[model samples]
Target: MHSMRLKDKIVVITGASSGIGAITAQMLSKRGAIPILIARSEDKLKETASGIQGRFGMYTCDVRDSARVEETFAEILHAYGRIDILLNNAGYGKFADFTEMPSEEFQDMMDVNYMGIVRCTKAVVPHMLERGSGQIVNVASMAGKIGSSRAVAYTASKHAVLGFTNALRQELRKSGVVISAVNPGPIATDFFKIADPTGTYVKNVAKMMMTPEHVSEQIIKTMEKSKEEMDLPGLAAFGIRLYGLFPRLADKLTYNVMNKK
Candidate 1:
């Protein structure tokens, strides 16, 4: 299949206030795409919009709210005419023992990480299906592929994201719309502030953490390439595949690595 050009395409990004989403909006604007930034923080969203090079729009949205998402997308369609891409990147993480994690905290992760994608995707899909062309990129994580010691809730939520992406891809096989999942391990962003408040994870993986710019570039490339899935940092991708092939040995290796930290 021919690669899709991003130039002049209308791209809607969730969590556009900062990190990957914000960087992506800037990059996409530079590449000639109109980026519609969405997040809960109106001021931060505007800050992101202010940095973009071309015409762009910012909408303050909490993805967990289905009604608001619907209304936001309606406004987007009215302004832009059509959405060529949807990047679902609104999510957070809180690492804690499964038993110690509060029920509300766990639900919050599910709401934003998993259902946020569901709500946004549902809102935009019909338009894509009717038009018969579009791209949906879900920014998942390496945690989605391999379970870690201290992130039960976060891991489970990402796992669900992967499942949703895969299932949606299959269902849209004949449709022109493309579905992709990006799994990047430990990105250097404000996400760590909440995910690892003590900075233990950040400290442990400081050298390993990929920058938001790097991940955003990969995501944009994936949209053009129409890849079904991608893993950032080739070595981590290999490790994830290895874990799938040899679970017992991989488990032992993981345990040793965690123990060292």
Candidate 2:
């Protein structure tokens, strides 16, 4: 078979417990990349690492802890001598109508979702620049492109991610570092289970959601090509494009049909 092998290449993945991060480790492993899974929950990280036994490693640290993130990353770099890919996937969500939400909740979202990416990218970029080659994939959401009610903080963080990817890709264009963002519509994960146990969003929107594996497959393909942007489930990207070009009509249509309100 053709090798998408990341053999000898090291990939540092944050938020690597369950969901996208978990699946990505396996996929990268299958492709030959040495996986470095990072998450705050050692138990879960170990569980994931155990299942993916190979040339994989695990680190338990909260991505929001900038100093720890940088320190642990340094440790990894010194240990491995090089890091070839960085996936910024550590994130948390606190969803509610913006006006009804506590300020701390929004702050927390920004800290974990946006700052986590910032810290990790900063820690890795120097090595990537020095090597003059690397890839950075930011795990954003479809909410990154579209403003959604009851998810103001999440939306803002993701939008910032898209912007960060765009700017960094430009700044690093001549440096041989590839930066991109993956906008996943809705991947089946415990995220929704934790965020809306009552099925607040999914109870109404599950019909359109795709599995985590689906998005993960797209991520693999995107990374293989070093693509700048990836919109998973294909349809979601189409929807985003169509609505962007026809806002007024799209709004009325979504509100009437999709919202069922």
Candidate 3:
């Protein structure tokens, strides 16, 4: 095992009931970090914490509710004194063509995916600034950098997250506060159940899907040492850079080849 740099760190994870959030909470606890798990389901939060071997906390919070988010963080800060790190991992996506997607669904994605991070980050920044140290990790998506068909809303929401994270990072450059974004390609999580109800997308890219545990490890790495961004599966990261260099060609490929998956 590597040195436990996260030992004793207080980590707050949102959308922590399942998927990458739940797994990362477990990994953080194993590293001796005190993970404060947040989700909309109190029962689910308890279930997630039940697997931990060490100290941890759970809060039932729907990040989509700004007032609830503020209250939750205040309660957490009061109990823990300070938050060493915040993992904004609570987000969901629904795959659909832009024209077919419901307006409410798009609003929900933006509320949870983009504004949720905004609410949580705002709640922690003042305290972290006062202490002169902290880390904020936003769980973005590969779609944020490279858009694809049938996921217009999700892609837009994630793009907003990356934009917010980048601007915040520059603003807090010398504030002893670290802001980073983690972008991962399709992961084998329940996300597909919602994002791809037809089962077509998952089936098409089953072999390429990464595991939640693998994604959690990358998040842990960010917590231990901050980086501007961490893109999983080195090959995918390369593809993103290549896309940037030649967007016209990339668009053709993204539409013709990648969108099918």
Candidate 4:
């Protein structure tokens, strides 16, 4: 149960307005970390900061906007002098068949989910490298590893995240900057409102959904040790391993069990 002593550490979190992002920020703040919140909505970022007792800052920066992201990081670094960690959690998903999905939706997914990580990481990596110490955690999803029915573009975006995280970790091999990925199964969040607008998918997976608190705790633990990668709930992680070992059987099971959602 050894964890990183987070007291007074500065953490930059994207998508900090709600769901896992908001919850994790609060938890870190409780542990005495200054959580720098970033989101597209200034009001929501304010709300998140309000719930935090420790010193915190908020910036409304959309991940899709690369220039804005760079400026935002510059401002944070100027104010704080250093950032101890970064949580790239700002992303959304739209569930639709590939043919029925709008072209813009696919592009948006790539921009926010994949390139967003790229833009934010590009902004922060040099600083971390220069300091010779830091961590970057990218919140990917189980869909990234095991593709499901209606989220083709979303799946591709997360897959890119995994690929980028793995490659960058190698590139930074002896640099002391740690990069990690978090792949979690479905969680109870407003994410479904956009990803499964009809509520059909949520209904199908109602019994299996994990709470934001549960996922946030696991994330905190990952941050504590600077773990290389994590897959949550144990069962889901086991399933992913089975998929790697038996693709044909896993594919059939995914179609029957997961695709229903």
Taking all chains together, each candidate's TM-score versus the true structure is: 0.96, 0.95, 0.98, 0.97
Per-residue CA lDDT of candidate 3, range 1-261, in tens? 865899999999999999999999999988999999999999888889889999998999988888998999999999999999999999999988889999999998999999999999999999999999999999999999988888899999999999999999999999999999999999999998988988999988888899999999999998887877999877888889889899988888777556963
Candidate 4 TM-score over all chains jointly: 0.97
Q: Please give the RMSD to the true structure for each candidate, in Å.
A: 2.2, 1.7, 1.0, 1.3
Clashing pairs in 3: none
Clashing pairs in 2: none
Report the lDDT tens digits of candidate 4 across residue range 78-188.
999999999999999989888999998999999999999999999999999999999999999998899988889999999999999999999997999999999998899
TM-score for candidate 2: 0.95
The lDDT per prediction is 0.91, 0.84, 0.92, 0.92
Poorest stretch of ten by lDDT in candidate 4: 1-10
RMSD of 2: 1.7
lDDT of 4: 0.92
**lDDT by residue for model 1 (1-261), tens:** 223388899999999999999999999988888999999999898888889979998899999899999999999999989999999999999888888899999899999999999999999999999999999999999889888877888989999999999999999989999999999988899998888889887888787879899999899988888888999887877888889899889988887554222
What lDDT does model 3 reach? 0.92
- Ordered list by lDDT, greatest first: 4, 3, 1, 2
Badly placed stretches (over 4 Å) of model 4 are 1-4
